[model samples]
Target: MKGKALFLFWTLLIGFIFSTNGTLVYALESPNTDNYQKDSSYFFIQYNGEEKEVIVNGNITLKLTGWADDSKTTVNGNITSVDSSNSTEDITLKVNEELNELPLNETEIINYRIIVADIFKSEIVTTQELTDSSTIVVQNNNGTSIEEVKTVDEYDTVIENKGLIYYSSGQSGEKLVITKEKYDSLNIVKDTTTIESNAVSEVKATPTTKSIKEVQPLTRFSKSSTPATTTTVANKVPSITYSTHIQKIGWQEAVRDGALSGTEGEAKRLEAIKISLENTPYSGGLTYTTHVQKYGWMSNVPAGSISGTTGEGKRVEAIQIKLTGEMATHYDVYYRVHAQTFGWLGWAKNGESSGTSGLAKRLEAIEIVLVKKGEQAPGSSERRYITPTSVVYTTHVQTYGWLQPVKDGAMSGTSGQAKRLEAIKINLENLPYSGGITYSTHVQSYGWINEVSNGQVSGTSGQAKRLEAIKINLTGDIAKYYDVYYRVHSQTFGWLGWAKNGMKAGTEGLGKRLEAIEIKLVLKGQSVSVSATQAFKEPLKVFLDPGHGGNDPGAVAGGYQEANINLAVANKAKALLVAQGYKVYMSRSDDTYVSLLDRSQKANDLKADLFISIHVNSTGSGTTSANGIESYFYEYNPDYPSKINEDMHNNSDRIKKSVTLTNLIQDNMIQYTGANDRGTDGSAFSVIREAAMPATLIELGFINNTNERQKLVTSSYQQKLAKAISDGVVEYFRIY
Candidate 1:
């Protein structure tokens, strides 16, 4: 055939063979006329000079003749049935009387190397009328000759070697061989074409070229061939390659198959990932998603595309990977991650979630492999998916009122503003177990208040009271799984150290106020850097003097020794001050002689921050009507009562500070005891005048008054006075 004519013929034939809409149509001759049909269930094979249709579960017979070494041989095979239920869904031909199942589209040697069938979904044949003049004779290697008739238009590229003829179908590089019957069915007027001798031998000697698609030899046998050579299918093993966008390092070099794609034991994180298949035998690509830090699970992306974030510093926490289309049928994609805190987790396969979710963990390293269908997995698949709990809290601040809630170790109150935290509410979110968080607080005017649980207010709100200290604890099953950690910013002290599991987080005895707070929930067994004990502010030093102790009882009325009353009140006040985180020193802890000069000298030598000398007032014997509280500070008057030294003149700042301290103490005493206010005064008294720090002298009441004396000697009245004094000291420090 002429090259141009053959090319034109093939162009028209190829166009007619494949449909534009994807459905295949075959033009079959019914021994008389050419007709077309859309049949995918049947295929036709030429045997001798007859066209036979092979159907599923049907029977057929063929006498396959081939030549080797210049000799001719024939083999009879009866195909009893065809089964399509195998793993690959290829048709299995039950050939010969042995009922040997031979898969189609594969090379097999049945006494001779022959391709049983290269079945297409559709078949077609083009014919032309021919005369005896068009016939040609081809000679074989054995000097044997056969008359080949010009049947149909000659194929554009036909290789006739030995007895077999090879031709291209011109559709997707498919190869086909023309039998004598398939040509005879074209209604040629001349002699029929026939196979030459040594057909199989010539095919075996000829090496496959790029013009033809290579056919894999069949590995299965008919129980007759040499235990069947295993024909390894090319590119059968999937090539899975992946890259990770790591922390610090960007996208790393891609790794293939089951190689590690991230880090191991380095504590680095995988922030993003790109997975792809190279030279894979499947039709579709891979799809994957990642559980990312802050963002959670991201949407799935196709193969070779990024699944998480990059340049955001967020970690890929968990992952889900899957194969699509024919790839999913033949292989399973299995992956595992070395997570932050968790190390290497169990293998997850085919879209199952791997690594930890909800927990703020990073995927440190990852390994991925493609396993053939029904194969053993790489490792155990026992892992946890954690939904971390959140601790939410709110605080009520002085003047500003209750603030909005915050969660997960966030600060909930103001700082550096001198505003006090007055109340608090706390709760747990997404807790994976039963029970809750409970807390209590110490407030002004009230000691440790009642405990509150799970969002209930812990301290006084709306009342101008300050929260001094707090204790937080977890309860029930929640406590079993986690620990609660908390800390506070307090007045005078700044930020205190962390306290956990019901330990106090703020100041105790010191009248300091809580300014801000932070709370956190940690998983059990996880390490948290906590202080050995709650931090505290350096305590202020206070010097207390019980006036006229031992034999020096300055006032006595109603069987009450003034020295005994002063000692009792001073002791109670010291206890209260010490509890508030104050360092208190008394001139006399018990009944002992302490002169005014000795008291002032002791306070100065100790370098006390504040000095207060306790005394009882009297207007000589019958002053029963005079009763009240008065406080005195020192003011050096050179011309009035006594000579003022240079050191006394240099104490102007001390004198002003002393006046403020005296007024605070006197006002609190009057409020607590309901004593008449005798007001504050300045006097050149030795106790106040000679002290280095701020100093004050408090006259509790007229000791000669019968009613006041009765109250001063009692333990309850002394405690009231002590509380008032301690409160006044707290107010003084808060202002300073």
Candidate 2:
């Protein structure tokens, strides 16, 4: 017993000496942050091209700054001033500095004038550079590849054919007569306003003012208005009005009410429709066809102005409604006047006719009539409403499925909004109930039910930020979704499948349950069995080492060997709690040469709840017998209070000196084969000392005793030995 105690004492002493080597650093394990916190320093240039800088020293701060020129379009570059004081170092910018804001999404390179002296803990001066000039590239979108001239002088002068003093062939009153071809070519087809397209038309005109009779051939657009002056009047203009129709063809079955659906006119008719997502006359129901067009008055009129007219009674341009579906007998879509920002608008117009324009909203408002397929209808609506973001399907051999919080609004931290499921249509070829349908609901962005284990939940893994611990469960039955769920892939551990209560899904009268979290799937006849009685040192991980290796051939005497002795001791210690229920992750079950670090790493990697490494002492004695037990633990996180370390060290020694553990085993060995009792003592092992959690390494007994060596080799001795180690763990937890 005395000898065994000495071994542990030395082991622990050596462990402490090596801990200050700096290899014991570890991160505090915690769940991910609840929200994103910006924490980076920045610099920027102002509109005047000056530099500034600021640093984010605390939690998070959103640095807000922008180029100063409101009228100039150079608003896209970083706004910072240059620093020239330091000759050997370049100055870095801070986001808080008024003149040092980083351009929005700009890739500003930070150039360091001097090389970093310490990569891990060093700071260097840096300069930031970004794109400039126009800041935002201005493109000519006039369609003709013509040089875009912005200044008034660039494209203003026109060389007369004979220097005839004026360019236009003729002018009527104040009207500039241009070739009819030019008017239609510009395709200036618009309701006006929204795009801010050339409010001031730049057409050439005579420099001097003259009476209508004197200015015979010169022509130009109306000039800036003054209080006393009025816009020139036109003698003749097209007089047009609505034909009392919203749609102009065979496309009426799908039109909705109140939605605008036709083009602008002096009296041109625009089209529209409105529908609800609940009920729909889809394909094979009442399908139809129609022509499509976009009629916009948004620039000139308000989004809320109900009718195709304005407040002052001016007839504003009407928008159009378009379509794409099956050819059918008839179609019915609803329509309602535009929804104004201020409130509601004009009367909702409903149209029912053969000739309809393909541009109408949905058909459910009862505001419009259905147009028969193949019938030509004129005058009304245009626009597509249903928008799509992502699409996914499942395969027979799938990866992931239904997540949790089956109930619609139950989850807390969300990765992102899951794409809403439209319908999973399964068209089977030769299967039971060939026409079955299943509705599926997804709750995670990557389609994964990601679970974060304590050890891995910390920043040790590759997550940009620590990920939360909660999981998202997909609700609803997914089976019978299609002939085959062909594209599903588990975004998490992979192959984690979907659940349907082990039955195919049917959509005869489908509605997802609101109480369900995701369904947990189990293997056929296999289930996850958890015991509440088991103690959980959650967030605490531990790795156990069953010592003595593949061919070490430990202490030998009278047909007895220490290698076998070591394995027996290790096995006994493990069984004790696996029974009491400690989550015990083992390093080696059978004899193996797990490197010291490899064994230590498993424990480290697990950041185990605690660690326990076992082994038996050996000695060369012709007539030998010696036995006892001892334990060890280490503590050293500089940031941690020294008191914590002192407490842990004291606790470890108490266990080593405890008589119950060492005595029970010693008695058994002595009874079986008389041997000397080496008293318990403590010494920290490298594994124990470097461990982030509490740890222990035990030396069971010396194999030098003639009778004891013989007994230690026996299976009976090993089991009794195992019981003692197991008892020790129970005692430790009970007391601690």
Candidate 3:
């Protein structure tokens, strides 16, 4: 039996959906079944199997077998022969009728099996004969009955059932024999457990919880006397938990961390069962389903939820557990079960089953293992939970320095070491977990080298270059589950506060030598007070251009100078922006004229993230009636601009960003000033079109409109405009 080949035959139902005339308008790749060659009309099969289509030949019969010469074949109904050219019924109408009964939005595949006694000239044993030979006994409460059995043989008669049954001690103390007819009709109330027939004996099963063990591989076929074995499963690692429903005993308590959950010595058959995870706060967690004695496998359920029936009294023979979300992204879970006759079944992962389904022998024992799913970058690193602990590190110097031991929150290098450090290493000496760390350093000559992992040397040995700056970050899953804190002692700035993740520990561009460093790892929920860093250390730069100045009055009317109003508003906005942590620049601080090209070029040189051009709109003296706020963003048109350079192309990339900025500024300005909402528009303004980043031009108001001009010149009104624009900039940063 050990060396014998396990030739398993599977019955797969496939339906081909084609358009009219039996021709597929579009083709699709066949399901990874390499044995089949899919085509538009007729598909060739490499293995003998059954397939269904909307219409077959002229007859509405299910296609029984492919051209492949294999023992396994499929048959549907009593059709003895099929001819593709025969007259066929209008299957389109029939298919539509059947579809009408299904929910419009619901999609499902319904399948059932039929056992045939004879094909053309060959006589065969039906599936019921195989089921009868298996001699498995299961109790059913009320009037529910199990479905008919499919093809099965003596060598593979056993199946892992997932449902549970109830039983009492009195029923198990003595062995009784129940005939198939009587057992099927009897209303089992959990009292009866052990029953014997001439062929096999019914045994009760109990589950127990166990602790996680070292990784191992599974042995496919083993005798009952053989000890249980385990090995690696998938690429991602995860924890598993399971609970069992027993006959008469109802549901036992959930057990995890390798502890068994089913009955052990108290001979009682297992019925329904549920499997889940110990912790899944961040992910979709675990999902699993079980194969019942009669019902086969049920629908999938999430962690801690049940799949099989409890009150109906069925034996759980097999099960499959799958991981999802963040948990699945990191690991996979595999499980197997041992039955009374079958000492140990094969291994199953994700959504695969291990035990015999039709065979009624009780599941005696079970094993589950977590395996990693895929390899991540920074190779040897893996994720693990972290607790509060000090990360100790030490650096070896070139000449006279072997520094004192440094722990978490302490600097390791000496700023005065003007001499080069040869090598450095780190360790989580006091932390109680399976994990490591990654660190990188900036050298006098190298300027930032590749990062090293888990107490490894980072700096060069022979080459003498003083370590100027250093950065340390956690490697593996701990990087996301916890925070690593580090600070550096700089040449001039002294000791800086803690920086987490990949934040720089020492100063750059200042030629500051890193004297020492400190490192610590904190659990996610732990509270740790540290220095705060601005979203942008040097606030985001912004360039404000007042549309006109000096000789150019810019749409002056009603004795109000558009240039002065623009300058006043820009100045107020600059003050407010500076106070709000922004580095603001103006094209003109006074009435000195600045060319449009110069304004845009200045903003580009400053590398501003945003630019705003302020101006007053006028429809001339006769059309002074028009007065409203309108914001314009640059629209990139290659033909109209004529000159296209790399910078212009880069500016073109921000067309969408400019639109967003214009809308925000316009909305905020209108809301604040209570001006007419003229809306955001696209324009080809010289200043905005040339400036990089999200630049926009705002026509504040009609200068010729007497009322609007009066309000625009007032200091209070100008401040309102400035504040509104400033708020819009803040909102833009908040979003992007």
lDDT of each: 0.66, 0.32, 0.57
Worst 10 residues of 3 by lDDT: 95-104
Candidate 3, RMSD to the unseen true structure = 21.0
Candidate 1 per-residue lDDT, tens place, 242-312, comes to 88877645557779878998988877778788777866654666789899765767777776556786434
TM-score of 2: 0.29
Which candidate number would show the highest TM-score if scored against the true structure?
A: 1
lDDT of 2 by residue, 1-736 (tens): 4433433353344332111212221111111112101121111222222221222111111121333343222322222222342112222233111112222112222211111010111122111211111000111122211111111111111111111011122234332333324433554533212323222111122223211122111111222243211222122111111112232221123333333333333222222221222122332222112222223232221111122211011112222322223312234333333221111122222222222122222121123333444544333333212111111222111112223212111221122232222212122122211122223322222221333221121111122111111221222222222112111212221212332332221111112111111223222233233322121112122356776577766556666655566766666656665766556677777766666557766776775655666666665556643455444444334453332234343354534433234444444444543344554444445555454455666665666665555566777777766666566555555554
Best by lDDT: 1
| Stretches > 4 Å off in candidate 3 | 1-537, 642-653
lDDT of 3 by residue, 78-163 (tens): 22224444532221111100001111112221111222111121111122212111112332232222211221222121212222
> On a 0 to 1 TM-score scale, where does candidate 3 land against the true structure?
0.34
Ranking by TM-score: 1, 3, 2
